[model samples]
Target: MPEATWTYLMDMDGVLVHEEHLIPGADELLAELTGTGTPFLVLTNNSIYTPRDLRARLLRTGLDVPEESIWTSALATAKFLDDQRPGGSAFVIGEAGLTTALHEVGYILTDRDPDYVVLGETRTYSFTSITRAIRLIEQGARFIATNPDATGPSREGSLPATGSVAALIQQASGHAPYFVGKPNPLMMRSALNRLGAHSETTLMIGDRMDTDVRSGLEAGLKTILVMTGISAADTAEHFPYRPSRVIDSVAALVGSTDKPFG
Candidate 1:
């Protein structure tokens, strides 16, 4: 496919930036995409921040991604809920990102016998909230989580993410959550739908084989794995599946945006 015709779905944290530092050539690639008028969305499984918030954060890192160019798991989850049960209420255990998306979707935030118990990323995982979520799930509230990421990266180290807490909730309530983020093709399909792009013509870029590459592959988009984040050079070999291309970083693709992939 001609590169000019290729739309893109890119992972945010590892592929673009790492904890407030811009990956080399990330800005250039985005500039090229924007300059060429290519359709692209910066995707993130982290539901902690809304697109607006993320855009601001990225701008701070010297990456000028527009708010509309960002897509979060929170938004994807909200979209799913809106489609499944419009105007439904959810007992949420998350911050503004998750809450704002749900709100925008006409979903009510409530703890009183809601239609679903929605979970997302939070810096502080409250014991009280988790207990309430468990009880609510046991009381017949359907369980939903923004993402299934077990851990998230931090300057300090790895921190427990939504998936880990979801496991605890499932153990207590005997109900597993339906994860709505990366590694789930639902996330990728929803993104493509949002971008108004076809999977066949879109490219997915990320650093992880487990989530990014896997989801892109499942969604039938060409996947490119970069070495700028969690995955090492040999990480793809351990995976049952492989990315369409593996490069050192987004840096390598700087001038090749218009070149056809072989």
Candidate 2:
């Protein structure tokens, strides 16, 4: 495999792996990138796990990814709040994963007089929890969402994802949240900062247009959409926004980026 023209930002779930299994050829693609110092990170919208946890998961899958390569919406959410709100208190309508990450970053998470409301894909979401979130937002509390992915398919089938919860919060609060996952510049900026590269020199590869392509485009990086998870051949034409390059899978970018863009 030859070195790519620019640094690559890789998406997890779809572009690399599927649940607890690695997608076919993912290891070879990732290994080629690492050997060439392609400068890629596992950008994931799933915030259920921390970066440390993600690192371990990848290792278990036989992909020796470093901790720094795993960047989740959980970390991005904390960074966004810390920058925008600056020591502000938040009422998290999310699971322990979100609140724990927020607390680790020195943000105050409290139920009383919270300046903002944070929402994510929480299995614990109930009427009482949602009602409290709406009440906070109604009282001038700002709203923040981790990701906006509507459905994530697993071995079981398609299931409600982070985007569903984000939609619910927006509908009830009558105010859309500032997203922090892929497609939202925050995730790209964080990865770029860590990789020490500019958008002109970076290439983001993933399977989702709304998230990966949008995020890369917003960050001024070249986008490559792979057809492994969400986006497919039929849906490509429907997206108002398109990636710079669309490949069948990450394997295309591995040995050679020689294929023509469709």
Candidate 3:
């Protein structure tokens, strides 16, 4: 094997783009990874869109990410649920992405006392659905959430996301959900398994220390914290664990040199 044989698991929102805008050098970095025949996947905690849907969105931002190269918490949640109980059913509170993933995994979507109450990100969460979820959980269905992100960035402002909704349901049902997204090493491990990569030679890049960095560290991958998104330079210092490197953006990782990182 090569001396620096490395694969990558990069966060999507902050590391590569912000909202609909591609961060500077993101394209170049992607090109470098593609050209080097490096195996990598763009990981996102957002379960709002499927990989095919997200690929189109990235294309609009001038990034050509293949659908197969994208991994979402929706996919991870489906895999997790499948591993736990194959061909089971769930009462889903999400959009097309989450529902599609579960369907692909042969999971039944229903509201009739299902195996799990799967919560995920949506443009607008309904109060009625949340009430139903609380009732289901109280009636003995296990609670599962796609991610723990309380709020999501939007054009207007931050909007309540899956975690926020999960909290409300938990408040009513008196049971915390098992969050399957970032900060949970299970998601990272699943991504690594998808890539057939070992943590010893993998890198995790993201902007958030709480989620990205924490998850990567727990997964035993070298972590890089960029400042283009949520976590700032000073914010890293407050975390109990530090990233392997702190850079301004993915731009610092664009070059093809085998010097670990540019």
Candidate 4:
């Protein structure tokens, strides 16, 4: 609010929208940030769709988030692998989002003793694919998952996500996966780096305490918990770590005088 001194890294699903519906005042918050030339990114753990795909979806929902402002777990996972093992091969169990990211990094997608067994978000989690991933991991492939989100929100209801499938693979293969999404500070750090924003001067807005708030805290960014999504205000106290600020929604921050997390 105070001349956009603090940059922002916000969660996409909960903070901005929920299951294809734009949250109240979400568009105004983005508009305000863009109008003031505030550096910001809309981050999401869902790796099922590419940035272009997501931007199209958001536009259909009446939230005009820029394609460049969107960052997905697929991109982060690709970046992580590139940094760790450049041009490495992976046996990916995901959709176009994950496969495309890996390809952009010059990584090969194969099942022939791949360097990593990459897991990501998908609507349909095939048992055959999970079995293949488990077998690959058992044969000494490192397990890498996009996120640890056990459940995903949908118009119908909650659906099993990457984390739930990751758990099953871990149980079978006896190998834990390195998650590259929310709740992991690395993801937050990557977003900060992309924005050229220092952690001390950035604020993270999210609705989930376990993923967004926790990751922001660990990444040394001030976190604000909004009650427009998954984590209710009452549930915030249940977590050991707390957000720097708690508000009813992003609507409250629109044109407010308070300069939070500066």
What digit string (tens of lDDT, one per residue) describes model 4 on residues 161-226? 999999999999999999999999999999988888899888899998999999999999999999
Candidate 1 local lDDT, 174-262, one digit each (tens): 99999999999999999999989999888999999989999999999999999999899999999889999999899888877765275
lDDT of 2: 0.80
Using all chains and alpha carbons, the TM-scores for the candidates as numbered come to: 0.97, 0.88, 0.97, 0.95
Q: What is the lDDT of residue 62 in candidate 1?
A: 96
- Which runs in model 1 stand beyond 4 Å of their true positions? 1-4, 260-262
Residue-wise C-alpha lDDT for candidate 2, range 1-67, written one tens digit per residue: 8733567788898888867677878888878877866677888888777777788888887778888
RMSD of 1: 1.4
Better of 1 and 2 by TM-score: 1
Candidates in order have lDDT scores of 0.93, 0.80, 0.92, 0.91
Count clashes in each candidate, considering only residues at least 3 apart in sequence or on different chains. Answer: 0, 1, 0, 0
**Residue pairs with clashing backbones, model 1:** none
Q: What is the lDDT of residue 29 in candidate 4?
A: 88
User: What local lDDT does model 4 show for residue 34?
Assistant: 87
> Model 3 TM-score?
0.97
Model 3: CA > 4 A from native? none
Residue 96, candidate 2: Cα error in Å is 4.0
RMSD of each: 1.4, 3.2, 1.2, 2.0
